[model samples]
Target: MSELLHLGALVPAAVGVGTLLAMRRDAGRADVLAAVLMLVGMTDAMTLSFVPPVVWFAALIAAGLALAAGRRFSPVATARPGTMVSTHLALGVISTAALILLMPAMPSSTPALVAPSHEHGAGSTMPQLVGAGLALSTVALAVVALRAERSWVHRLHHTTMAASTVAMCAIVAI
Candidate 1:
């Protein structure tokens, strides 16, 4: 279970980095900031299940600072007049905030979930199912953003940050 959650965290981090690289040519300050914020949140998720809470605590703080700084320093964010800018910031902050709230609530030592084993019931499996659902949702959102008439970067940023939100939910349930 922990391993799966950890893997889940890695997947999005990789995706964020790839998106960051893919967007670098056209990325403004806000886009880069948003990408970095997503990376930080994803990093925190990876640490939550294995490392001490202090690591994630630091990540949470860093994410908060980045969000604030991004909003203040990015000309595109401030100069633009659209929901996209605010939406990215909101998703990043909300995702990190939820992780901050949920970390301590997780059991410190949960037994590993065995595949094809009967030790745990359907109740225990719910988290995995939910995680899968969220993962699928992320894919669907990405596809929608790809096909949307709006600027692909803006739409994709919205979709990518949203992955962080769902990823946190999936991680917590795990």
Candidate 2:
């Protein structure tokens, strides 16, 4: 059931990416890059065992910083004042990184409770805190996305991707 929940979180992300790519011609470079980054972060979250946690942490941080900096420094993001897709995507990536870093080492398929207790230390609560933070950030992004004057497709993509991150965060906190 836990595995199903984890995999289920990926569905919205995949759909969002597909939708964004399908309408890439209409999207700004930042929007397209953000969507791709969100998808990559989600994929890494689900496949954490394939690489070391530290590697995932470093990669995600770099990706998040790059996304944020790219948006801030890019002429496109500066020219467009209303759209916050890149901001949303950067937060999602960073949130995923925090989730990954806080999570105790365990096989991705194992339920959190099923993992050996020793794997969970006094810091086990950190993931829950991070999850809560991510949830709040997701909600804020949702509001921004809804209010943005972008196309419906872009708004939908942002919403779905944000939802996917929240779902993954919730699952990890479980």
Candidate 3:
């Protein structure tokens, strides 16, 4: 499960890098935001102590990028308002959730919040809630995009992203 989780974390990073490559000549707010997300995912996939700081930095940058993208592709100005808003918002949500997941576990002597045994570790409930929230947000974004977008490419991308987010969320929860 841990190995699968690590693999799942790479999916977004790969997609983000691919999108950045595709926009080589004409990169925009979306591309830049995707790059930030890629960095976040890549850092999170690692099991190093330094990962926490890197993920925090990436999450901060991604959050800023999400704001910029949201402004650049405002719903009123963009033809695919749903897609534009949902995509950036989803990125922001996932990034924030990643930050929460990296939070340190409390001491073993502490009482368990939801488990009878101390096996699960501390700060578990918050991460699980955040993971579930991320999954739901991603799924909702995909649905909104599927309903609003006319392009097959975009539809496929949204579906793929939603699936990846679901798996990543499940991994985080576990």
Q: Whose TM-score is greatest here?
A: 2
lDDT for each candidate structure:
0.51, 0.67, 0.53
lDDT value, residue 99 of candidate 3: 43
Model 3: lDDT to the true structure: 0.53
The sequence of per-residue lDDT tens digits that candidate 1 reaches over residues 1-174 is 655655655565556545545654434555455556546545543553443444555655566566556655664423334334433443455445445445333433333421121335755665455445544655565555455425655565556555655656666664
Give one clash count per candidate, in the order shown.
0, 0, 0
lDDT of 2 at 25: 49
Better model by TM-score: candidate 2 vs candidate 3? 2
Best by lDDT: 2
What ranges in model 1 sit over 4 Å off?
24-34, 37-41, 44-51, 69-74, 77-86, 104-149
Higher-ranked by TM-score: 1 or 2: 2
Error of 3 at 99 (Å): 5.1
Poorest 10 consecutive residues by lDDT, candidate 1: 109-118
Q: Model 3, which residues run further than 4 Å from truth? A: 20-30, 44-49, 53-58, 61-86, 89-100, 103-124
Q: For candidate 3, lDDT tens digit of each residue in 134-164?
A: 7787778678767876765555556656666
